[model samples]
Target chain A: SQTIHQWPATLVQPVGSPLSLECTVEGTSNPNLYWYRQAAGRGLQLLFYSVGIGQISSEVPQNLSASRPQDRQFILSSKKLLLSDSGFYLCAWSRGSSYNEQFFGPGTRLTVL
Target chain B: AQSVTQPDIHITVSEGASLELRCNYSYGATPYLFWYVQSPGQGLQLLLKYFSGDTLVQGIKGFEAEFKRSQSSFNLRKPSVHWSDAAEYFCAVALPMEYGNKLVFGAGTILRVKS
Candidate 1:
């Protein structure tokens, strides 16, 4: 079975500090990866998605960026974090099809203070 | 543009009671629909999805949803509610693209099951 992993499970970062969140999938190759943020009491917002290595698509313009360094490894990064950047970050993988279901990771809770 | 709407922000039901959550979408044509559940501080779980045929779709955790194209709605229902079912439910629509589809999620409805 395929599984997604994300870390650190929880993070506390100072304003203007750098941010880095990593996501990886096992038991699958060339899977579609996505990055999403969920604010408190709100639904998810898609930040970025990648269909293959070195290919990333931004869904919305914001303070975050994504990179697919490897086939199954995706990273979300920011040169400088903002207070609004604080939220629960989720990483998901799909079978590269429109009808396939997405599998989500445990998620990372980043608190920017 | 395609979008999803979940009317209820929160709902409370007694254990073993019937439950229904409303979802409506705005799209030009019939799009792929899905239902997901999220526990507090956890990621979303795929409950069910409707692509074509079978207006009613069964999902995990004893949950199901019916797609009504005439009303542009896909509402989730469960015959009996359980305490463990207390969580946030989200409705999503797939926006087709050349390579894949982008999912637009609703604001979500939080279900509170009281025993």
Candidate 2:
């Protein structure tokens, strides 16, 4: 069975602080990874996706950036966090095939104050 | 360009009543549709997906969705509602290009089931 893991299930960061969120997948190889942010009572907004290591495609250019340092390991970072950067950040993994059913991680709830 | 639309922002139903959520999509090619559920403070879970060969697809947690090519819709249904079924539902359509893995999602439908 494949499983995705995210770190810092809950995070509270002050404004203008650096941020880092990590996501990793187990039991799968060369899986596509994605980062999504869901606003309160709103839909998910795709931030970034990676097909392979060092191949990150950002959907929305904002204060956040994503990097695939290695296969199955993705990182979301921010140089300086803003109030708008606080949201429920979810990491997902899908097979490289056409089926592409995304499996989500536990998620990280970020609160900026 | 491919896009998904979930017309219902909020839906309320009784515990034992049949529930249906409407979803419409727009795409040039045959769309790959998917239904997902998200509980409060949890990640989205795939309830069902429609690729081909089946108009009606059954998913986990006793949820089913029907794909109508004519209407460009894939509506989700549950015969009987449960309090546990009260959650946010999302409709997604996969892009039919070289980057087929990327999906475009709708605004989502929030379900509130009364006891």
The lDDT leader among the candidates is 1
- TM-score for each of the candidates: 0.96, 0.98
- What DockQ does every candidate get? 0.63, 0.62
iRMSD (1 decimal) for each model: 1.5, 1.8
- Per-residue lDDT for A1-113 in model 1, tens only? 99999999999999999999999999999898999999988789999999889999998999999999999999999999999999999999888766566889999999999
Model 2 RMSD, rounded to 1 decimal: 1.0
Residues B1-115, model 1: lDDT tens digits: 7889998999999999999999999987677899999999999999999999999999999999999998999999999999999999999987665545678889999999998
Off by over 4 Å in 2: none
Model 1: how far residue A15 lies from native, Å: 1.3
Tens-digit per-residue lDDT, B1-115, candidate 2: 6788898899999998999999999999878889999999999999999989979999999999999998999999999999999999999988632573888999999999998
Label model 2 with its docking quality class.
medium
TM-score (C-alpha, index-matched) for candidate 2: 0.98
